[model samples]
Target: MTLASRPAVVILSQASHALGRKIANAIDGDLHGASARTSEVDFAFDEAKAHLSYLFSTGRPIVAVMASGALIRILAPLLTDKFFEPAVVAVSDDGASVVPLLGGHRGGNDLARKIAAVLDGHAAVTTAGDLRFGVALDQPPRGYVLANPENAKAVMAELVAGASARLIGQASWLSNTRIPFAADGTVTLTVTDRPRTAAPLELVYHPKTLVLGMGCERHASTEEAIELARTALADSGLARESLSCVASIDVKADETAIHAVAGHFGVPARFFSAARLEEEAPRLKNPSDIVFAEVGCHGVAEGAALAGASPSGDLVFPKIKSKGATAAIACGPAPVDPDTVGRARGKLFVVGIGPGADQWRSPEVSTMVAASTDLVGYSLYLDLLGTLADGKIRHDFDLGKEEARVVHAMELAGEGKSVALVCSGDAGIYAMATLVFELFDKGGISDAASRIEVQVSPGISALQAAAARIGAPLGHDFCTISLSDLLTPWEHIQRRVKAAGEGDFVIAFYNPVSMKRRTQLAYARDKLLEYRPATTPVILATNLGRLGEHVRTVPLGELNVDDVDMLTVVVVGSSESRTVVTGDGKSWVYTPRGYSGKSDTGMSKEVSQ
Candidate 1:
């Protein structure tokens, strides 16, 4: 194996600084002591959880000199034996190697080989990989496919004891590594010291799996809570298959998300009782308490960690916030070797349909929604997307209840649950996308959270569909102005109209002429006439793309004040738009391509000759 791809080393020693640095660097690895710094001299085990978390999270190979045992003792209480991380080999200051401590297949044996080569010393690597090639899967490492990540520690433990292991679906590059496979096809394995009859059972592993669901009433987020849990589990040698559920704070244990996780992992969604979470809660620097209490736990990370560990392992209290935390499953004890696996990112998509109509939808939109695992939005919107929501989990809320929908979808995704947040019309056009981004920006989340990738799927707006049905009023660049005084003040709307008049932009009116806000649109149209031609074409599109649709074009000066309603979209064309004659003698309104003589530059022209 190339040295470049080799996992780096971490040297931890209380004294014997000279020997520690030399021995660790001989393997061409970084010396952890020189690379780390802490001003607080009284730093204890959990205090360094932040730094240790960074090292263990990398899944690298590790080696520790049998030091004041402070490094090992401080770390031992937190790691799990199951994950494939850095190999850990222990040695004495006298330069004598003793045990292949952590990461057996993927870590420990490598440490043994490096030590043996450095001082002409003996490395206590009794594993099959080291004994055979004196090279190992953790050394001249051959990456193996462990079906279940949970059995990694147990398998590594056996191999280091000189037990035989046969890997199935072993990748080709691993042929030279110590762990062997039968070239014939499926390889058999035996984890015990006594060899058993060569069979598939000797090597099969069932992966460890976890499901996390939490809320914070305190300082911790899903990220912080889960890392603490991961460290504890990694120290004990357990691996999680995947996190796959999140339930609302009020949802019963019998809820679908909860039960589904149980069926997936063959384990129950053990609740990290809300009260217990509150007791351990740290004071958050931001708006996290509301989220935590709403979801019932500080964060699902705690649940994920607890579930990842041995049933006997206790919950580890969390340390202070990481300075922009590192993504890690856990920092475990040094290993003889480890069995690392691949990572897949979770997903979330939010879609808006504009005012309402399929014709306004973009192709990029429907495709995204079709691929999502869960759907979230208002009940009416969900019903509108009936065909798409058929089998997926629907997180439904009331119409104006936008924040809850975004939070719920994000929470579900953070738990490693792929989900989608549904909106009406372009999500960024004032639906759910903005809310989605706000949640992420708050840093009110957890460490274990799989950050949800927020995507906005665009759809047809009432004006665009309306414009298409009546005339080319929107062909020229246009600005949309909403007359609703609920959000934008009446003064702001007036200022915008003044700007639109100066810019020569086609103007589309939303929330136009609502009964309660009768004067705004009238004031706006009068303002537009100040700069625009009195005959500027006004097309009122009502019920665009829906049953009972109607579109009418009138002169701006002739607009009937009483005819406008909230459902109507008022589109007033710019000065360049005009009425024209089609080849068939049918009359049509259009905003001409500036090069009207012949050589066209419009989108349609480019698409054609």
Candidate 2:
């Protein structure tokens, strides 16, 4: 398994915040600080141990700027399997000493060394194998998998005790290690692409040198495709861990069966254009004119395998077929790099950033934005991403051109790029998600755009934020109405306002007023007063979750248009809503759930008894 890329640098005291920032910047990680002591950080937490435990549970590598003993005590209970754990390193508050306390082979030693380089300190790595041989046998380098890990401990112990080992296959990484190698030795280290069994004093490593090319008919069964590929690998006597990637023609980039086969092998699915595959016609063992007439390529499975395995590679297995799928395999001269060979399937993420705070942003939204190659949204929405948008290619649009931004995002994703369409509040509620589906339903978009994957991630809305800032004015039923009337007709908006007022539903007005539009909020207040009392509470929350947040309440009779703007969300309480003043001279508002009626009935029954 690969190590987690982005680490989190955590600090307990304000004094360690500076050192944490330095380490975080060096590693391109997020900085988290104690909420009671530190102010300026990417994230703040109330308890250090709880936060650290949460980060660890989420598989986030941690670099804590604190005492080693304290971190050990806090995380001692969570020590399970060492191989699956994330790297944890503890650094002194003065940035002098660095120690890898957990996941030494998984990445803790390397992370501690990197942090020590930034601080000009030393990494205290106590692992015997790492300290003596400068490598971990169990944790092989990328593009190589250790077949038998249970025997690694015994082999390493023998090697550390002055036993000579013999190298069997082509392995440049083992040449640099501090291993005593001889022409004849008792201990053996074997590396190959073929399947092999290990002896008692042996460790077998498999290099990812094979590529599997696949093709399937439309709506083919995923099980059939996977079984065909697995049968081909087994018949050829090849290890599944030695497979580099699953490749096919670009037209099948969105094919479910092809992607499923890749997923089954835990490898990436890459695609090449038909023309690129046609160039390998001379090397294909099975080329057909009928296939060329159908797909513009002579052989999809064989051609893709040869092309993906590099020019000098050899096709080992040629054109094995099932009822609806074809599979082939090829061996390369060296380990293949899947990313440099073919294009990946495109993905579009419609993400809502909530209001503006990092704390309010959902974890899935953050992960989508970080994985995105391009970010498309309004200027203010892109600006809200702050440091997270640093390295991304940004496509900014003005406020009035909402359709233009969504189209640009879709077009970018069509070109095989991961695009994030940023939105404020919830993406599905008055956001770009509806427009995306509308484009798909209307049949006006390009074919590539239609084939690209789409995902919607939800976020906290402005109404929810406003309701939380004040007391729960939305305790009962509620509805939201946009008052701009730019795209919506004024008469339709007025009718909805009248209906909500008659139904006595709590109303939250979004897009209350722009600079050019006014008088809508005042008209809504007048209409609501006809059903509810004049003393009903009206909440005006401006800049929710942003820098200058403000929430206040007023009587419905006193509500006016001048008090609201585009940045505000206005909530009008129903007739049953009540406001109370606390001892601190602050007002809170909430709607009752009718528990008083139940109390009265219970008291009557007691009196009868």
| Top lDDT hit | 2
TM-score of each: 0.46, 0.93
Model 2 lDDT per residue over 450-486, tens place: 7788999999999999988889899888899999798
Q: Give candidate 1 misplaced runs (Cα > 4 Å).
A: 1-306, 310-348, 354-360, 367-379, 392-419, 435-453, 583-587, 596-609
Where's the lowest-lDDT run of ten residues in candidate 1? 334-343
List the global CA lDDT of all models.
0.53, 0.89
Best by TM-score: 2
Summarize candidate 1's per-residue lDDT along 287-310 as a digit string, tens digits.
245446565545443433332332
TM-score of 2: 0.93
Model 2 weakest lDDT span, ten residues long? 1-10
